[model samples]
Structures are given as C-alpha cells and as structure tokens.
Target: MGRLATLAALHGVATVHSPGPDVAVPVPDETVVAVLAALGVDASTDEAVQDALTRAESAAASRLLPPTVVVWTTPDPGTSGAVLPPALPRALADLPPGTGLRVETERGDTVEWPSLDAPPTDAAAPGPVSAAPEGRSWPDLPLGVHRLAAVAADGRTAGAVLVVAPREVPQPPPRTHGFLVQLYSLLSTRSWGMGDLGDLAELATWSGRELGAGFVQINPLHAAVPGDPTDPSPYRPSSRRFPDPVHLRVEAVPEYAYVTGQGIALLDGLLERAAGLRAAVLDKGALIDRDAVWQLKREALEIVREVPLGPGRRAAYHHFLAEQGQALEDHATWCALAEVHGSEWRAWPSGLRDPRSAETGRARHELIDRVDFHSWLAWLTDEQLAAAGRAARDAGMAVGIVHDLAVGVHPDGADAWAQRDAFAEGMSVGAPPDAFNANGQDWGLPPWRPDVLAASGFAPYRGLLRGLLTHAGALRIDHVMGLFRLWWVPAGADPTRGTYVRYDAEAMLAVLVLEAYRAGAVVIGEDLGTVEPGVREELHRRGVLGTSVLWFERDWEGTGRPLAPESWREDCVATATTHDLPSTAARLTGEHVELRHRLGLLGRPLAEEQREESAEVADWLGTLTRLGLLPADGGDEEEQIRAVYRFLLRTPARMVGVWLPDAVGDRRPQNLPGTWDQYPNWRLPVADAEGRPMTLEELAASPRLHGLMSVLRPSVVN
Candidate 1:
C-alpha cells in the first residue's frame, strides 16, 4: 500500500470506493489530508505526512490494547447449548504470554482471567482485525460494558473498555402492520395549529384499538434549533437526545388545572388564541405555523409554571433531574444561555462557548431559573410521551409507539455544543457523488468521532439510546448505514471531495443491541437506496430489521422487475411510501411529478420527467394487475393505493407500515426532497384528496381510510 493509503486505512478512512460496478473512485489527496486533519492528525505538508505515517506504522507495536474491545459470545456447537467463553480479543491474545489480565465488570465485580490462556483481542487496530476464538478459550462473561486492564511481564500496561453484547437485537413479536405519520402534520381540532402530543396519543389509541393496528411510527420529535423561523425538518434536529417541548399538549399537564385567580383569565386568553391558531390551519386553509404554535404554548407554559408542585410530583421531578444528571444540566444551560446570547454557541464569548468553562459555570448559576424552566419543559414532554405509550398499550397494541431516530444532530444544536469533544470540528456528514446527484449532497449535521466515542466508552451514544427507547415500542434508525460508516465532507468543500470514514460497526451494533435488549424494543433500520455490499446482511444477522419500499424492491440481480411478494425479506418494515418520497396516491396519479415541476426541481423537461414517472408507476401497476392484486379493469386512485398496501401484506415482512396520509387519499408528499423556500415542505397539514385539511376526528371517520384498512391483513377490521 502507498504511504497515504496506509495512513488512511489505519484511520478507517476509505482511500477508494466503487460508486458503480467496476468503477473505482480514488479519494483525492486533499480530501485524505483534510479528513486526517479532522481526526487530529497533521498530514498537510509532505514532511508532516512522513512523520505521521511513521507514527501510524508503529502505533500497533507501541499500543498494548485498542481503546475498546468486544466479547461476542456464541453458542458452542460441540457442546450443544453451552456458550463459548469470552476470549481476550486478538490484541490481548497477542500480548506477551505471561501478561496478567484484570476486568472490572459493569456490576463492579472483578475478574482476573489467566493471561496465559485468554485469546488475543482486536490486534491494536493495526491493519485489520481477525476473528475471535469460538472454541473453549475462556469463561463466559456477563453482557455489559466493563473495564479491562492488562499488565505485561515487562511491566507494559494498557486499558480498554470491554463490551459484551447479545448476538442479536430483540426480534419482533410477529406479523403486524402500523401507520407512519409525520407528527407535525397530523393535526387535530385540539392541536395548537399543528399536531401535538395529545393528537399523537389520540391517533395511537384510535388506530391501535379500532383499526387493530399493532404500532404507529412517528417522525423524530427531537428538540429543534430555536429560531424566529425554525427549520421545519425534524431530521435536522438541535438535540436528538431530548424530545422537543413544542410537541407537548399544554392542557394535558396535570398542573395545567391548578391555575387560580388572574392566572385562569390569562390562560383562558391563551387558549382562545390557540383555538384561533388551530382554526386558521384546519378551516382557513393556512399552512401549519410551528413558530406561532410554540409561541402560544410557551406563553401558557410560563403561566402554568407559577403553580407549586405537589409532594409526589416534586419527588418525581427530582428523580428525573438526578437521573438525567449533567447531560440535562448542560442542555438546559445551553438553552438558558441561548435566550440571552443567541442560538449559536460558537459566536458566544470564547469562554462561554466551552460548556465546562468557569464563565459558563457562573452564567448557568445566574440563569438558574431559566435553566430550570427548560429542564422542566423536557420533563413535561417526556411525561407526555410516556403517557402516549400507555394509551397505545391500553388499546391492546402489541408494538405501541414506534419512534424514529434522526441520523445526526445540527452543528449549532445543544448536543454538538454540550458534547463538543465527541464530534468532528470542521466535518459534516453527507453522501459521496453518485448517479442521483453528480454534485453529491451535504447534510449539515456533525458526526460523532469514533475515536472519542470509544475512549469515552460510548457514553453519549448509550445515553441517547436509553432516552429514545424509554417510551418506544420500536426504534427506527434513519439512515441506518451511518452505524457502519459515514461520508465526511470538510467545510467549504464539495461533497465530491469527501470520503467514507468507517466507524466500529461491531461495537456500534453491539451497543445498539445491548440497549434494545435492555428495553425489549425491536429495531428497524432504514436501509433503502444504495447500500454497501453485506451491510444489509450484517444488520439482519444482528436482528436489526431493514426497510423495504415497494417501488424500489426490484429483482436487480436478474430481470430488474418488481420483486415478487414471496421473495421479499421477512425481517423488515415493508411500506409503499415514506415521508421523503411521493405518497402512494401521488405516485399512482403522477401528481408528484407535477409538484416537482411546479417548484422547478425537475432536472429535465417537464414532459420527459412526466413520461418517466408515469412509466415507472405503470410498471408497478401492471405487475399488481398481473398478480391479481389490483383490478384487471383499471381501478381508481383509492383502489390503486389500497392495492399497493395489499401487496405489502402479501410479503412475509414482520411489520408493514401504512403512511397515514395514504389512508385518507392524500396526494401531497409530507416532504419533497431537493427543494427549499420554493416548496411548502414539512409545513402542510394532512389533507384529503381534494386538498382540504382534515382534523384527526375527520381522519378517523373517513370512509376512504376504512376502505383501505379493509384491504390490509385480516387482523384489522373493515
């Protein structure tokens, strides 16, 4: 290998990739240097490259252990049911034969494995890792993150984070179907202009019990960046770790009932305004105004804060305060500071930018009341989420509320500010150039540094998982491929100048599996679009279900025809549409093309785009007609939409998701990719085929939705 190639390989940065079959793209030298720089390696100058290369070459020899190690115990084939021992990974095994090994387990128990017998650990992250011992090498260890230290015969010492995880994640209970709704767009009469937690709970209860649905998956409700006009996209969240307070239903808070005297008059006025906001959207045909909704809710929340908490509520609040610990404090502090300084932490006074600096400490204390208010908002939202889950359970749903986890956090969000050390400074996660877009794409969210995560024992990742799974029946990871690797683009550079940086997929999956196992929640990975070879298989092997959109599930290796229902993978959340794509109704009628054309997002002539889109839709419809899933005589838009979902039910997929809007014959895509101000992306309320907004109650009573649900599995009633 070349010097730069060797350095890049050692750092888990890809030097070459095949964006297409038999075509290799060698990463640019500048890209490699920039990526290495982001990882804290100085390789700008030739002399610096040589020096860095020399250090990297000797890193394995000088290192006693990697920052982290994994002990994935498998069942012994020879012994039938016995589990194989957790061997010392290749790195530890390759140590001097007489080295002593000590482990401190998560439970605080200590174990001293005989140094002579333990298998080696991952080989110091040198060139590549080898397979672990599957035979009778060591004793079976508990599944948890532990601490391991090694001392060699010559007094050399090293320590590593030891992670023991289940071989797979929790599996789904059985075949079931659910609805996938973008939370903001599913407004109800009671909603304050847009969908709130109250609407979510009502939808869950009605669908789960009345429709016999097993789950209801919603888009990310992660804390959004506070701005005069906030970014409407939930995927670009400020903090994926905390739920956004704007989703909270003000009237549902227990304390909302206790306001007395003049407080009642003020709250009544706020409620009247909130009703006007809701009416403007549902009756006046105005777009959902998230900022206005939040303003009203925020004002009412400030009023509600005056009521003193009872003893039980106070204790519960204290428990939540203590459980969240410093993470909550940092997030609340950042929010408090944002109110004073501005939303961008980077532009704040230098010392204040450092979350742990003395200046930030004093500021936190001075603004303790505001900090407490933000923290309280988080607590209230969390409580409502838990209540929603309870409502689902009460409705006899098997998989209650399935939640989505966004790929990463916004750079200026609380997570990036609070956990600054764990993210790359000048790098953003994106995709490399491909057939879809020659320019490639840059998602302005910062990725977590694999090196920092390993050294910190993946504390931040674990905390994130725990928070999300606290009330989720299942967790759908958006852009699941990010668990394995991410395309990192340097600031001010085209995405074509980016390269894929590998993460420790094994460790990442292990942590994920461990957390899901603890929560007893199934995981569904969004593995749509171009996937790297073997990634889907690996995710499946770990019991992480893949996403299969009907439009894209063709027999690519053979005839390139729509895949037969029987041939679809059983472990997936099968669906006809997603929030990013055209709704089934739109796809069937070709309105999606017209919508794109209207926004000037079409790359070709209008007629050409329409022709291609219509052909694709006709191809799917023809397949459906051939298989007798759809009427041989052309059916209407509603029948075609039903047939699309009916085809999903034919597949052995464990869970099928029905986009909520499709149930009511909605043609507008919740989000149209590749457009900004030109389109009303993520701002429209769920409406009917006629383009009229529908309240949650109206949606529930829609005969069209009932007719469509009848086409689903027999579990759901007509």
Candidate 2:
C-alpha cells in the first residue's frame, strides 16, 4: 500500500488520490470503505494493508502525545544558581502576578529570546506549562521550600519555575549504630533447621542488651517462590510486601502447646528435628539446610493449625486479616496460581493469565481457604518480626531493628502478579556495564513504569515502604537509585542494549519520606556503582543516608588509593562489608578469589588477579600503617579487626555497621554474586575464620569479636 493510503487506512481514515491532483485527500474510514467497494479493490481482503496502516497510525499518535516538561530557572543575577530550600512546595506558588515567560538561546553570544505565546516552529516544541494561579504566595504554596522562579513584570520574578528540593514530609532520624547480622536456617535451636522468629528475637535481645549494639540489620526475609527446592537466595524474593512464614518458630505459637492427644505425639518428632537442626548449625558448623527445615516446619505447622485458634487469638487473626485484606488476598492468589500455573503466569492458560479475569476470580473463590491459610502465615511472620523489634527496644538498643529492602522482586512472583499494571512488561531490571561485571547483569526482575507509578500516586511503592517500616527503626533500600531511574533491558536483549528509564524521583522520595517519617524509621540508600552524578547529592539533600563500603572507597580524582577515613562522606552509614561481599577475614586472607577460581567461575585466572589485587591491598595496608592506623605485625585476627573499626571510627559517618560475620571472623561471604549453585548463596551459618560454627552464646564470649566491638563501643554508644 502507498504511504498515505496505508497511514490513512491504519488510522481508520479514508484517502482520495486523484491522477490530476498532487495532494491526497483524507476521508473517514466509513467513507473510504464505501468508496473502495465502489472502486472494486475489495479493501476488506486487504488485511496486510490494514495492519500496516494501524501500526503507522499508532506510531504517529505516540509521537503526538505530550512531551515531558523541562523547566529551567535562571539563577539570581549575582549567584551561580539559586540556593533553594531543602523543600520545594512553598517557593513554587509565590510568583508575582502577570509574569511573562520566554525561552532563551544563544547564537554566538547574541541571545535570542523566543516568545512563550508564539514559540519558534523550528525550536523545541513548547510543552504544556501550567501558570501559577492568581493570589498564591510562594511561602504558602504546597510545593515545599525549594522552587524555581523568574523575574516578573516589575523585574522581580516572572515565567515558568522548576522546583528542586527535599520532600515536605519529615525525615526519619539517623540510625546511630547497628550490628549487621544474617540468620542461617540451620542455626536456631527452636527452628525446624531454619532460623525462626524466636531466634531473631533472642539474637536481637542478646545483641542489644549484652553487646550494646544500637541496631540489628538482618538480611531480606521476603517470601521465596514456593517449589520443591525453592531458590535459597533471600535477595531473589517472590514478594517484597509479605514476610515468609517459614521463618516462624512453630513452638512459639500460643496454640502449639495446647494441641490435643494425638497431635502432641505427632508433633514430637518435628520438634525434635527442629532442635536437631539448630544444634547442627550451632554445634556441628554445617551450612543451613533450608529445604530440609521447610519440610519439617511445614509438617509441624500443618498439625499446629488443627489445634483451633482460641477466640481472642482468632479475633487477633481477624484483625490482621482486616489490616492486610486485599494485599493478602492478592499475594495468596499469586501463591495458589503458582502452584497450578507453574510459577510463571505467562505460560499459564490464556483464560487464567490476567489476574483480574473471571477465571482468576473463580479460582480465587475456589481457593479461598488456601488463601486464608497463606494470609495467616503472613500475619504470623509479621507478629514475629514485630516481636523481634520489641525485643531490641526492650533490651535498650538505640536505633532498634533495621530491615533490608531488596532491589526488586522476582518477575513471576507475587508483586508482579498482583500489581502488573504498575510494572513494565517485557522489560527486565538490570545494571549497566561496570568495572566488576564487564557484561552488565540482568536481574530478571520487572521494573515499575514511571508513568503508571505517578498516576497511581506510587501507592504500591508507598504500601511496601509502610509495611516494611512498621517494625523497623531504619530501612536499607537495596540499590536505592531505583527510586530515580532503572536500567531496563528489553526482553530478549542483552544488558548492554538496556537504557536508563527515568522515574519521578521527587515523588518517589517524597512518598518514601512521608511513610518513613510517620513510622519513625531512618532511610539508608545503597547508592553503590555507576550512579548518575548529583543523585547522591539529591539523596543527601533529602536527609537520606548513603551507604559507604570500605572496599569501594577510593580517591576518584586522585591517585587511586583507598579513601582516607577523614575524607569519607559524612552523610552515610559506613560499613566494612555487606552480605553479598566477602567477610572481612575472607578479604584479609584472600579466600574469596580462591573460592571463585575453585568453582571455575572466575572471569580471570585466580593467581594472576590475586597477585594484582593483593598488591593493591598491600599498598592500602602500608598506607594504613603510615597513617598509624594498622597494628604492628604479629597481631591476631582480633587485633586486625579492631584496627579496621578504628579506621572506620575516624570517619564522620553518622552510623557504622559491624557485620556479624566480621565480628566472628567468618572466612566466607553469605553470598557470592555471579555464582548460584556453585556456592550456597544464603544458607551459611555464622562461623569463625577456621569454618568453626559460632552460636549466639559463643559469639557473645569470643574475645576476637568482643575486642572488635570494644573498639566501636565508644564511637557508637549513646
């Protein structure tokens, strides 16, 4: 089909092309179809032409949709730029009345000012700009503090203004200190081979009271996608909204003790297995067996559910049900669907694919009881998490418990199934090419569509924050830059082909601050990697703390030496290492590189890279020695750890995180990225440098661990 004819046909427009006329006349679809029949072309049989036209029209329409508005505010004459307030609302509304706006361009220093009313045709098309309403004062405006303004009719201020500032909502107070820890499935005594809520509470209480730790930051406890052998990594979760019930301490339930005759006997073996699992980790130094623990607990919980919930407990359950309501239903529906549809909803029956379809509705009703059970599990998990937080508070921890928010949820999981509209289909969230991973990594998680998110007022994001912040004194946002933009790898494309899609950072941050402020929780952004310039500045401006990892700290512009503690950014939570990284002992001893090479997963040969990397580390150690920070030779591991903390103490960072593994001199990292089955990702227990398991009790008394804390005690203690 001809271009004009195809475009017209696709758009449902009729086109008339006369031999004598150069111009083609466009007519409506009805008219064209009737005329085509009269001409005997049988346009109804022209499906190819019709499809082409449809696509062409769609492309054209997309181009015509409103462009994003980019407002630029001129700096006050003498100043380089306006020193906007931390907040933006108040300043945007106070522009003087009857202000005339103009766009300026420079042609070799001769400035050309284009009229706002009659914008240049060749110039960038003018986007829709809403003028300031009459009689609104800048201070009284709801835009907060920092806002853009221009000179008006009296040369004071006029034209469009862009507001760049912190959210109006109050920010959560900083977490003064924290002891970062990870719970292994095999470590807790009461767990069915998995660390349970009871253990979490116990650990929090002990760490808070005896160790004088202000906060306890745990790994992500998000529910995993259910399967025979579930994915062990907590970072890859099914749902960020709900906690996994597998972490529940079965014996801790009030009704467990009240089980009748046969039930009690049946539960005995499960209880024994639970105790044995805990012993294995605490005594035997074995890695946590998550699948085995789940098997034991699932059996135990099935029996426990038979012991009827008492009236008061049932009422409390109902209250939780009420609080969770739709979200619970959706999550449970997702779980049930996964069981029937096999995880990925895309491969499911056509009728059952859309979550809102009648097939899904009927299935939801049919599986109502199953859904209730899942919801109950979530409630139990929440109760335990709250109890852990309370234990920290009761034990007198300053900042109490801090929770980790994973970067994203699994694509075929609850959040994706529940809020599909908010997520971008056929796109995966990933990282761009970086020094560590030459080939960028695709996380296989769907990203939130910026347009959809803003239109919904970020309700899904807000809800998640509120839920997580409920029992947390501080929240660590994994890959916090996701709030601003996400790297979107289109389906079937490599990570390199991915582009950065922008998000309403201001809106997202505002919502986050609002929820965190109300929950009285501090926010920490894991702003690591190839961050866009000014993102950290924006986060700092918003009272959000940045993450400072010791290994990554460097003099970016100078000779590449490890950044000095005094020169480190103050607006951050400084840490020796994270869950995904090598533990301090492992790094100091060079075990991590060796482990990678042994698995045949190292990008380069182990010995060669080790030599180069070790030399850098040796140089860093020399620098530390020169600065009087490193201890003299022949010191034990404990002394070495103390030296590391002493260096961290020198930084002006508001908070310092003492990794639990580091305290115990654990030689292995809890997780090693880029290697899945080759190594256990999240199943390792807290062990000593020699791979000897350490119980909470032993950890408390270990002089090596204790000495390290002693160094940090004065710096973190209130």
lDDT of each model, Cα atoms only? 0.87, 0.69
Total clashes for model 2? 22
Instruction: Name every residue pair that clashes in candidate 1.
Output: 89-120, 89-121, 90-120, 90-121, 90-122, 91-121, 92-121, 93-120
RMSD of each: 4.3, 12.7
How far out, in Å, is residue 5 in model 1?
Answer: 1.9
> Candidate 1: minimum summed lDDT over ten consecutive residues — where?
122-131
Task: Please estimate how well model 1 matches the true structure, expressed as its whole-model Cα lDDT.
Answer: 0.87
- Name the candidate that leads on lDDT: 1
Error of 1 at 282 (Å): 0.6
Query: Per-residue lDDT for 585-635 in model 2, tens only?
Result: 878778888888888877777789799868866766766677787765625
Task: Assess every candidate by TM-score.
Answer: 0.95, 0.78
Q: In model 2, where do residues sit more than 4 Å from their true spots?
A: 1-175, 279-286, 714-718
- Where does candidate 2 have its weakest 10-residue lDDT segment? 137-146
